[model samples]
Target chain A: MSEIPSKWKCAVIQLHSKPMQLEDNFNRAQGFIRKAAEAGARLAVLPEYSLTSWVPDDPGFADAHVDREYLSKFCELAKECNINIVPGTFVERHVDDGKDMLYNVAHFISNEGKILGSYTKKNLWHTERAHLEAAGNNPHTVMDTPLGKVGLLICWDLAFPEAFRALIIQGAKIIIIPSFWNLLDLTEPAFQRNPRSEAIYLESIVISRAFENVSCIAFANVGGQKESGFAGLSQIAMPLMGDIARAEGAHEQMVIGEVDMEVLQDAEESYKVREDISRPDFHYPVYAKN
Target chain B: MSEIPSKWKCAVIQLHSKPMQLEDNFNRAQGFIRKAAEAGARLAVLPEYSLTSWVPDDPGFADAHVDREYLSKFCELAKECNINIVPGTFVERHVDDGKDMLYNVAHFISNEGKILGSYTKKNLWHTERAHLEAAGNNPHTVMDTPLGKVGLLICWDLAFPEAFRALIIQGAKIIIIPSFWNLLDLTEPAFQRNPRSEAIYLESIVISRAFENVSCIAFANVGGQKESGFAGLSQIAMPLMGDIARAEGAHEQMVIGEVDMEVLQDAEESYKVREDISRPDFHYPVYAKN
Candidate 1:
């Protein structure tokens, strides 16, 4: 096995995303990239649909999005910052079968200004199912990089452990989540009264997922206003230790932390936790036809 | 489908056990059952290995452990209290292939003094793997009860979402967990610095698991003292409201709450969440040969 990196600095770019606004989002992303570069980070992540926000209102809007200029700009940002970058997610417009199709694609940008590989979100949220195309037949993968094997997931995909475990089995040392987790005032009376509860739920899940998998999870979430609320508690959590850096509320901020694998010796060897699930007794419904 | 119950009250019996003292354990369990029955709880849950403390110090002890009298007292407690009971877990002593084997079993007792069904734990925690036998070939089943389709899960099984999701797919209305989550000062510097972090991680995961599945979860955990600490925090969590009733810290206490189907209308109809995982873009290592 390759020597686990002793020190790996990462940054999360949390933004106050304006829905359907391209220039505003791009400029804001550029600022975060610049800040991350200044902080000497080796890897950086942005929130889901960082350049366009979430749940597109217009169908035709994705047709012309993320063209040559947009794609090159991200590649250039990675090159300029000299950091491996995950530019949240972009609505990739392309031709599938005989018709037009758009998928939410999370791309891994190499430090040398090249697109390494990408993962199309398989699990689409209820709101996105009607608005976006799902990667129904796609295979899961881990993006190989100098820092480590990085697993990528979009917003709603966080709800499924199957996706995360797949990446871990394929040797994912770090998992990156780009979430537009804006938990608004729901019609449910209880949720309405306790608006911040959703954020708390999310923050808790992030820590548990990281500890269970024995990998570093970098979560980047968007910041939203009061009416269209966002429970923006983005964090970087490591195995067993929980969150080292956490952003609070719907305020635009940047969270930075070092994800060091050298520190996980006690967890990996003592428990053999990853091996705990190796037995054949468990079941997964994804493969179940019924 | 059977009509979802309008309101169902449940109880979680937390204990600070004296290992191997079956009388002390049973007497304590009886006291809690009596209290829950008085509080109008139709269903009561006890912690894992409630009949005896975990990892039998001596092998011969199992032969004399769960006698007919001990078993009947639990059943009689359920019958007397007039409440359905999940007696946490009993270390069932049985002979297989002319050799003695011990298995941890979670039993469901009917209010009418009948054995409704039982679930043997498939996933054994690392501490117990060397000391106890695993349920490799056992078929998973949700206990059919008057309250709801109660799916049973033990501690350490909580880390594996695959097992949890399987229960949800089988139409589990309320998932019951019996955990003995004891926190200790870790050798790892980070986890050692903050001992209560594991409990925090667990609390977060419980809330998310319930909300995501749209199932009510009744968690029962044991209490612990200074050196060998237990992060009790046993809770009754619902779809969107998070924890309605939670036991704070590692204190022996009974938490009671009504699992109401009326309040879940907003969560169930608006999002066909279980259907969100319908597509086949997933992976599971349990099926992996290697």
Candidate 2:
């Protein structure tokens, strides 16, 4: 095994984004990014819908609300800090013909103020289905970056293994998920919701996702009491080391995670998850066509 | 909300097979199955290679050792107990065009002394590749039983999500895994290993696999000190209940798990994991063939 020089540190920013306030959101994001840079983080990540309070229903919201400013600001911040950044998600409006359609798109920006790629969350929840359109084509993307092959996903994508496998097939070593995963409790008091078990559910998936893929995962989520209140167990999990760093529940915090190639290599060698996958065609039904 | 009559209880038999002593192994299995029946289990499952101390490097092992008696005995046991039994795996020698090849096949026996179906494991680990063969044609099978749509897989198949997804697509409400998941370690005595941490890794996958697929999982494994000391964390995790019961590490024990339709329904209704999988086409690459 060759000895590497320095470990790549990643930062997950858990923010309490103000409702409908773009200026304050970016300001908060900027402060966190600067702190992450000072702490020697080469890559900083934010949560899904970090700009505003979790998007509630408003038909004309996408057409009137979203702007190009968020992208420019994120690019500028990435360049200023000399670090790659995933600045959460924006409600993007697209014209398919004469109609305005909305999508939840996450932008990946490099340290050189260049847009690497963007991916829309394919699996939309019950609430999101009312307004946002799921991606018309493939939603998974693995962009080659200086730090690693960064795969972008958002929120509910964690529930789907196919998303991760798609990226892995395309050579993703690091998977980044920007999530606004709220504790989905029933609105009425009489509904009988189990309040305490949400973290167990979310955290279990996070740790297993990293373990099964044999890749580094950056799961960033929003903080504070919103919706049913976000379960802010924002974490960065390596292949072998379960959780490098994790945020407290519902607390706005910035935690650093070290992604070392050696640990990843060791885990892969020990488990042989990738190497053991000899017949991907048999497991994956898609390959039957050829 | 349907008021179901009685919960279907399933039992996972964690065993320690005596090396090469086939009679002693069956006697052990018979005792566990009896105990499971006494404990009110409708479906009883055993660990992979539970009939022998896991197949070692003996080229003539399958041809010389394996016989029809094991199958007849298991079928008789299932009939005697009147309980569905997945009697782990057996090394069966198959001759195609007069050539002898070996396969580790999991046999599904009905409660009426009839062989329901048999499935060979698809994903073979590094160690098994030396002696065994990877499945060639349609390795995935979901057998319909009175208890549930039972999906069969063994050991290392847990590492692959496609196996689970393939079964889920076939309407499997309960997935049964007969595993001989030997504790993966550093292989050298010089490399320090933490025994306690293995359960956490195994249990996490069990819980997440159940949650993601919205299906109940019956994970059975061998119990004893052998290859890297089998991590006997055999568990039954419901979609909502997580792990209803799990074996203590490396302990020879039998545990009961309730596979209630109401619990499964409630979990699906609340989380909507099955319903919310809208973009299966995009997420699953195989759907692109159409």
Candidate 3:
């Protein structure tokens, strides 16, 4: 087991990114990282597609191979600010068996600026399937970090609890999700009953994941109006306290909260969720080993 | 696939049963079932341990083998009232080999008074483990019923998403949970952080389950004060409109809501969670076939 700190602070930076504006988005994210570091946050997270936004169709946007340089800038920022970072996700073009394939990927960076690990989004949103290929093998990414054993997931992946289960089984204590989730994701007829369906889904899912897995979840989502397709509600949640810190609305801001290992330990003792899963006699669904 | 009705009404009867008062509890449950049927509900659910309140250590309570009689009364009530029922859970004593074992079990009864299926609680609560043996084989119960494909799960089982996944994979469209869940489930330190932590957990989990599975959830919890260990938030939740009807507070009441198959179909199409899981190429967690 990795040595985990008793208490540490983290921040979810909810930012609005302009489509196709890589440098501008990076600079804005950099500003948020500096601010979070100044606020004594040991780890900071950014929203999905923070670099080039989520315009899937534009060939120009797809051709702009900025993932490497974009990641380098985030690594430099992490080292400079002396904090760990999850630089949201960027679209990566990989040639698989002579065909071009695009994958949405999120990376975890250490405070010393080393890339820890990356997770390609396994569950793609309906529209994104047309443009992006979901990760085919060993999709879950859980790695040791200065913050603790951390796991990484992306936007629509939040809807699938199996992804979270796989990570928890692998001993992920702090799961960071970088999402570009939007309220408009629901159909019009469905939304007619409850206008805040997606909002409820985001809040409920985050809290449920924390409590069920007996872990902490830091969700960073883009902020904007419903028309812009951003459901901000970026939040930091632990087992007992659902949302210690959360974005007030769908607006650009940094939400900060503390993760106390003592409280998490107490919850583990009270709930025994991890213990139950670990027992050889107790049967629960887990990802089949490849 | 069973033909599901376009629209139907259901009721979650939040009842507080006196400890060991099997007769009175059955009478009260029958009254509520009649009320629900009068209110045009096709199905009605009761809270766990409704026949004998959850006094785990009472030897007298354990020896009182009322499971058969209690279920008989419920089946008769279903026939009389013309309503399907999930009559909460009962302690069943079954002789395994040479020893007697107690199991916490829930059942699904058709409106015609036939027992559709029974599910023994697989994930026992910390306290429940002492008195009840968790189901060791085929824990999930998803059966064809008048209400289409329905699933039955007991209280603590809600904490494990894998349980829900198993049921959904078995073609359950409406999941019913009979819970004796209480706010006092949390430890002192957890309560200090958020006194309403369990409430948040119950509500959030219900909504999250409904949304994530693209199915309807009827959670029936005992209603009473925190001292009594009843966290009554009995609710009927569907994908888009979470908690269409929920208990006003921790009180004895019947919460009714309409379930529209059309709305469920719309959600299934919008989320495509079922479609994603059904695709053999999309690897997700499911219970190992026995």
Winning candidate number (TM-score): 3
Model 2, A1-290: lDDT tens digits are 12322478999999877777778888989999999999888889999888866646544346434567778988998898888899988888888769878888888898887989899888776678887888846546688777767788898888888778777766678899898877654232212334534566677788888888878889998887644556899999865567778997687889898777566666676677765443455445422122
**Model 1: lDDT of residue B4:** 42
lDDT of each: 0.74, 0.76, 0.85
By lDDT, the best candidate is 3
Write the candidate numbers in order of decreasing DockQ. Answer: 3, 1, 2
Query: What is the C-alpha lDDT profile of model 1 across A1-290, one tens digit per residue?
Result: 24536687889988877777778888888888888889888888889888777646665457536464676888998898888888888888778888888888888888888988888988777677786788865767887787778888887777667777777767777889998886763455646545665665686678777877777889998877747777888899876667878886678888899776765555665445555544353344233221
TM-score of each: 0.92, 0.90, 0.96
**Candidate scoring better on DockQ of 1 and 3:** 3
Per-residue lDDT for B1-290 in model 2, tens only?
12223478889999886666778888988998998888888888888877766757654456534567887988998999988899888877787669777778887888887887788877876677788776755557788776757788888788777788777777777888898876654333212323433455686888889888888899998888645567888999876567888887687788887766566676677667665543355445432122
TM-score of chain A of 2: 0.90
The CAPRI classification for model 3 reads as: medium
Q: Which ranking of candidates, highest lDDT first?
A: 3, 2, 1
Q: State the lDDT of candidate 3 residue by residue for B84-109, as single tens digits.
A: 99999888888888888898888999
Off by over 4 Å in 3: A1-4, A288-290, B1-4, B288-290
Interface root mean square deviation for model 3, in Å?
1.6
Q: Residue A150 error for model 2, in Å?
A: 1.0
Q: DockQ of every model listed?
A: 0.41, 0.34, 0.69
lDDT of 3: 0.85
